[model samples]
Every structure is written in C-alpha cells, then in structure tokens.
Target chain A: MSTSERLIESTRELLWERGYVGTSPKAILERAGAGQGSMYHHFRGKPDLALAAIRRTADEMWATAEAVLDGPGTPYERITAYLRREREALRGCPVGRLTMDPDVIADDALRAPVDETLDRLREHIAQIVEEGKEQGEFAPGLDGEEIAAAVVATVQGGYVLARAAGSPTAFDAAVRGLLALLAPPTR
Target chain B: MSTSERLIESTRELLWERGYVGTSPKAILERAGAGQGSMYHHFRGKPDLALAAIRRTADEMWATAEAVLDGPGTPYERITAYLRREREALRGCPVGRLTMDPDVIADDALRAPVDETLDRLREHIAQIVEEGKEQGEFAPGLDGEEIAAAVVATVQGGYVLARAAGSPTAFDAAVRGLLALLAPPTR
Candidate 1:
C-alpha cells in the first residue's frame, strides 16, 4: 500500500529470514520496491523501521496465542489446541527467532517488544492453568506460572529441534510428550 | 596448536557467535592467529573448516549430555540434573544455534552432524525414559520417544525464552514446570 507500510512489511520479512545483523537497508529497500529516498522519507533509518516491524510481529504473535488461549474450550483443551495449531515449523517462531539475533538483544528499544511478547504469552498460559485448577481439572498444588513457562519453552525449543533435524517429527513428538506429561493422572 | 587445530577451534567459536552467513574466511583466520595461506593449507575453504567445527561442536554437546544422562542415580534424577545443569543461557546452545543458520540447514553435508546429534540425544533420553517406565518410576503408558523429544525441546526452548528476556528466570521456571509435570502423582 503506502511506502511506510511497505517498508514496515518488508522489514518484518527480512528480519525473519536474515536477522538484524545479516539484513541491510539496501536489501530492505530493494525488497520493498522502494528507493533510498522513499526509505528515508518514510523513516529515520533501519533501526526505526525495524522497531516498527518487531512490534508488529510481536503483536501478531500475541494475537495468535490469545485467540487459542481465550477460545471456548476446557483449559486443557485450549492448551492442546494452541500446541497443535498449525505452524511453519522449519521457519521457526518469528518472535522467538529474534531472541537469537545479537543486534536485537543488544538494543533495549528493539528488545522490549520481544521480551514483552514472551512475558505476556507466559502469563496468558498461566491464567488458563489457574482456571483449570479452579475448575478441579488440574492438580491444585501445581504452580501455574511455572507450568506456563514450561509450555512456552517447549514450543520454542520444539522449533530449534525441528530445524536441527530438518524435519517436524521432533517438534510434533515434543508436543505429544508435553501433552502426555500434562495429562491428568488416572486413579 | 597446529594450524589445522587452531583453525577448527576458531571456526567453532565464530559459528556460535555470528552463525554461518555472518562468519567470514578472513575473520576465521584472524581469530585463529593464522595466515590466509595457513587456512588454505589446512582446509579447502570455509565449508570444509565449518564441517570440522560442526562435528566438533556436536561431539562436545553429546559428551556433555552423556555425562549427565549416564551418570549416578535413577532415571528421574539424571533427567533433572541434565535440565538443571549450568548453562550460558544468553549465548544459546553451541550446536543448537547452528540450526538457525540458513546456510547450514541448506547443505546436507553441513546438516548431518546437527541431525545426528539431536537424534542421538532423543534416543538417549528415550532410553532413560523407558527405563523409568520399566522401574515403575513413571506412568507405564507414556511414550518414551515422545517424552524424550519434549525434554529436548524444553531445553532448546528454554534458551530461546531466557535470551528473549535477557535473564535465566524463564529457563529455570520452565525446567521447574516440566519436572513438576513429570513428577509421579501421589495418591
């Protein structure tokens, strides 16, 4: 659409594929079908555009997780749905991948959205877990925050494993294993 | 160290920090305290040297995991020790980080060690899980392979979370959560 929108969109895709260090302003302009003048006219520089892109990606990630977590279902069902939801396993999580970028982590401004997104996801999962406990669906003594952190870690780690293996089996297997572990104990 | 040995060591460190695309021939030579001729004298080029580094990193990763998985105490204890082991959380896993490198994943030759290392780890963990099942330390019906994959994912994912937050709390919490899920239900 607009030059600004195109620049932000292009920055998001490039950042996902190449990371901050690997990405260059020239490449972003080329990808966006915009020129140097358009880029500067639209934003101050790469960092400014990148911050917008990171925030957009973070917001998108939260929205996707929020839909599943807040969707109508039992707490366990919702958690399972979120895990089983389709993903481009090899590409990895857009937000999660940013964590590996040295340039992104070194800058507080760029890193804030990344940290906030993960923290919010953990909290969202913890809320669902607490609801499960209240409904007598989960062990009352279980700590929701801890379990939520584990859920997030498993998903992130699953991406790393799947990418490492060049297949999605490890990813699927990890999800299956986590679900099993979270299954209610049979008396 | 010999020229070849120094070259390989330097390549390993560079690969860990900057990834495949970001690492350069000149950079590797400089880091190794070797000359350009010395690099070519030892290896064919960057790819050749990288393979050595990848294999070395993979072997080192396995050795570290094996020590814990094969060490003292029961299956549960071993698993817990491995999860709780000290790590440079922000730096990420040496071998695991390679998975994020587009170049490494694109080359079959480069990807072999990464795949093998992860596969062997899953199998190693699966073996322990199976033993735990047989010993009646875990639920009999749990799939050892699935649980093993989940355990591996948690560690990989833990790194992602910790790096995102610039703290180890999420990583530690994730471990605590998984262990809680894995704990045998008390009647």
Candidate 2:
C-alpha cells in the first residue's frame, strides 16, 4: 500500500484501540512505518489525518450495513440478517466506539461522518420496517422510525454488555431477547 | 474535604470527561488544587488514585440505580422512572464510558470496578424484570436477564447516538423506542 493508504489504515486501527484523544501522531507514524515529514506531507496534521480515517471507517460501516439491509430477502429476513451478521462483538462498533471519544465528538468535521453513518443506517432500517408494514408483516401501529432507533441501540448497547462481561453471552442474550420481541406472535 | 477526598473527586470528574487514558496525574492534581507532594503522599501514583476514584464512582452509580430500581412503584413504573431520570445524555454513562477506555479496560484493578458496576446494575434490573414477570407485568415468556440487558444497552447506546448527533433527540428517541417495545401488547 502507498504511504497515505498505510497511514490512514494505521490511524483507523489506532483510533479504535486508543481513541482519538489517546492516539498521537507519533504513534500513527510509527505504526504506519512512515516518518514525520511523510505524514505532514500527506496530511495537514493529526486532526486532518484523523478526519480522513474516521470518514473511511464510517463509509466501510455503512457499506457493511447496506449489504445486509438491502439484501434480497423479506424485511424480516433482512433485519435478522443484519442483526446476526458476524461481528467482533468485544472490539465494539468502530463508529459507535468513536462516539465515546470526547475529542472526536467535539470536532464537527470528525463527528459528521459518524453521525451520518448511523443516521443513514437507522433510516435504512426504518425504510425496511416501512416496507414490512406495507406488506402486512408487522402491526399497522408499529412505528418504523422508533423500531429502527431501538434496533440500532440494541446493537450498540450489546457491545457494551459484551465488553463488560468479557464474554459475548450477554450480547447474544440481548439480541435473542430483541429477536423474540420482533417475532410474530403465535395464536 | 481532605486532600485524598479532593483528589478522588477530581479524578472522577477527569475520568468522566477524558477517560482513564486521556487523564493524567498532573491533570488530576491540578483539578484537585493539590500539590505534587500531597498527591504522591496520599497515593502511590495515578493508578492507585484512579482505582479509588473508579470504586467511588461505581458505588455512587449503584446507589443511584438502586434508588430508582428499589423505589416504591410497580415494576414498569420503577423501570420507566429509571429510564426517564435526568442524565447528561451527551456526556454518556460514567461507568459504561470506561469500557471504551483501553487503558481503563486493560488494567485489572481499574476494570474490576467498572465491570462489577455494570454486572450489578444488569442483575438489579433483571431481578426487577423477574418480579414484573411474577406480577404479570411482563409477558410470561420474556427473559428477565435478556430484557435487562436490552434496557441497559439502550441507555449506553443512546449516549453514543446523542453525542454523534450533537443533540439529545437521538437519546430520547432511543429511550422512547425501547420503552414502547417494553409496553405490553394487547391481543
């Protein structure tokens, strides 16, 4: 990979591990095997480089979600696919994890991509719910936007529980419970 | 307050604002208005002081949750009261926030209090759900542990969404969405 590509990838990994505040330009350069001059030549500074990294990560996350949400299947099947998609549960969501960093959240440029990624994902999920409603797959009174919000929260929160317990059991339990709630009630 | 007490309080505030990795001993001492000699005399170092601060915060969080969970009311009422309780939504959950701090999670001493706090809180909520089930407030097939996990995740994840959006509206939406799901469905 080119120096710029390597730098951005290193920054993304560092951001996930050390967060924006804790990650230093020196560390990123070292991780990327690039010198100070090379880093500065490629980007304005740490913040500038971080913005690039954040946006890249955000796009990747959205693309992954889109694959599941826009997959060829019924709304229930697609939503379930999204929920059951393989994930590094303990590592947590890259975009969701960035929200915990005060430095990242404080910067409008850094925060925008993160916000848009989630907003778009939630909208996509809401649209699917809307589709489900149209097909009579859900109760007519169910609010698509509200259910979408809950779906996103459940996934994000599941990571918190999983990380805390040092096990994914809690995460699985939470997802199972949510799925049970979403299942069609038997007569 | 005594120097030790002041130091712990300052550490707590810094931890909440910047996290364990981002917070430094100098920052803690400065915030406490204590000198280097006094800080070192009171504690071994930042880790020692941080452990005390984390434990203190954990206790405070548990006490606050218990106040809402064990209050006089039906299970739903108590849970709703806890959810509706005023919070600095954008600032995030103090204990839950620690999970995102690599330094905090890497240290066994630092991580224990954070882990235990969340565990106890989930257990506390699960017990409430169990009671609600017995009282016929929740569906008979609902898993108390699972529902409890979902409730906790919603709050933690809600902070992520709120901070990303730079608005409390996302947080409110997440909470309302979860509460709607928890509401009993009429046949």
Candidate 3:
C-alpha cells in the first residue's frame, strides 16, 4: 500500500482499539511505518487522517450490512442473518465504539461519518421492516422505524455486554431474546 | 466529604468522562482538591482508587434501578419506568462505558464490578419478566433471561446511538421500539 493508504489503515485500527483521545499521531506514524514528514505530506494532521479512517470504516460497515440486508431470503431472514453474522463481540462495533470517545463526539467533522453510518444502518433496517409490514409478514400496526432502532441497539449493546463480561454468551443471549420477540406471531 | 470520599467522587467523574486510559492520577488529585500525600494515603494507587469508584458507581446504579424495579407497579410499568428514567446520554453509562476502555477490561479486578453490575441487572430484569410471564402479562413462550438481556442491551446500546447522533431521539426510538414489542398481545 502507499504511505497514505498505510497511514489511514493504521489509524483505523488504532482508533478502534485505543479511541481518539488515546490514539496519538506518533503512534499512527510508527504503526504505518511512515515518517512524520510522510504523514504530514499525506494529510493535514491527526483529525484529517482520523476523518479519512472513520469514513473508510463507515463505508465498510455499510457495505457489509448491505450485503446481508439486500441479499437473498425474506426480510425477517435477512435481519436474522444480519444478527447472526460473525462479529468480534469482545472487540465491539468499529463505528459504534467511536461514539464513546469524547473527542469524536465533541467534533462535528469527526463524528459525521459515525453518525451517518449508524443512521443508514437504522434506515436500511427500517426499509426492510416496512417491506415486511406491507407484505403482511409483520403486524400492520408495527412501526418499521422503531423496530429498526431496536435492532441496531441490540447489536451495539451486545458488544457492551460481551466486553463487560469477557464472554460472548452475554451477546448471544441478547440476540436470541430479540429474535424470539420478532418471531412471527403464533397466536 | 473526607479526602478519600472526595477523591473517589472525582475519580468516578473522570472515569465516566475520560475513561481509564485517559484519566491520570495527577488529574484525579487535582479534581478532588487533594494533595499527593492525601491521595496516596487514601489508596494504593490509581487502580485501587479506581476500583472504589467503579464499585460506588455500580452500587449507585443498582440502587437507582432497584427503586424503579421494586416500586409499586405492574412488571411492564416497572420496566418502563426503568427505561424512561432521565439520563445524560452524551456522557454515556458510568459502568457500561468502561467495557470499551482496554485498560479497565484488561484488569480483572477493575472489570469485576462492571460485569457483575450488568449481570445482576439482567438477572433482576429477568426475574421481573418471569413474574410477568407467570402472571399472563407476557407471552408464555418468552424466556425471561433472554428478554432481560435485550432490555439491558437496549439501554446500553441506546447510549451508543444517542452519542452517535448527538441527540437523545436515537435513544428514545430504541426504547419505544422495544416497548412496542413487549406490549401485551392485542390479538
């Protein structure tokens, strides 16, 4: 990869592991195996480089979600698939985790991609839910947007539980509970 | 408050705001208005003092949740009251946020209270859900444990969404969605 590409990739990993406040420019350069001059030549500064990394992370998250949401099977199946997809639970959601970083939330530019990524995820899920409601697969009174928000929250919150307990069972239990609720009404 | 009490309170605030890696011993001392000798005299070091703060936060969280959960109301009402309680969304959960801090998660002693607190919360909610199920309030097929996990995840995850969007609406949407799912069957 080019120096710029390497730098951006390294920044993404650091930001995921260390958060914005913990990650330093020096660490980024070292991890990328690039010099100070190379880093500056490629980007204005830490925030600029972080923005690039965050945008890339956001795009990747969207692409991954789209693959499942827009893929084969019914809307319910797609959502189930999305929920069951492989995740590094202990590591937490790459984009979702950034929300906890004060530095990221304090800056609009820094937070935009993160915000947009989650919003899109919720909206995408809402659209699928809408389809389900229209097809009579879900209760007519159900609100697509609301269920979508719950779905997103379950995944994000699962990470928090998993990390706290040092066990993925906490995460699995949450998903299972949500799926049970979403199961087609038997009554 | 005593020097130790002041120190612990300051540490809690710092941990909530800056996380484990970001909070420093000197900063803690400064915030508490305690001198170096006083801080050292009160605790072994940062981690030790941090444990006290984390425990306090956990206890306080339980106390607050218990008040709502143990209050006079239906199981659903109690759960709803717990959900609708006022929170500082931007600041995030005092205990839940620690899971993202590598320093805290890496230290078993530091992570214990956070893990136990959440686990206890899930169990507490599960018991309430079980009561609801037994009383024909919730669907008989519902797993109290699973629903409890979802409830906890929603709150923890709500902080994530709210922070991501820089608005509390995202959090409110998730809660509303989950509540709708838990609503008594009309059919």
Q: lDDT (CA) for every model shown?
A: 0.90, 0.87, 0.92
List DockQ, one per candidate, in order: 0.79, 0.73, 0.85
Please report the interface RMSD of model 1 to 1 decimal.
Answer: 1.0
TM-score of chain B of 2: 0.97
Q: Report fnat, model 1.
A: 0.81
**Residue-level lDDT tens digits of model 3 in A58-137:** 99999999998998988888999999999999999989999888788889999999999999999999999999888777
Task: Please give the TM-score that candidate 2 achieves against the real structure.
Answer: 0.96
The residue-level lDDT of candidate 1 at B36 comes to 96
Pick by DockQ: 2 or 3, better one: 3
Query: Per-residue lDDT for B103 in model 2?
Result: 83
TM-score of chain A of each: 0.97, 0.97, 0.97
lDDT of 3 by residue, B94-114 (tens): 999999998899999999999
- Candidate closer to the true structure by lDDT (higher is better), 1 or 3: 3
- Candidate 3: where is the Cα deviation over 4 Å? none
**What is the C-alpha local distance difference test score of candidate 2?**
0.87
**Where is model 2 chain B poorest over a 10-residue stretch in terms of lDDT?**
B178-187
Tell me the docking grade of candidate 2: medium
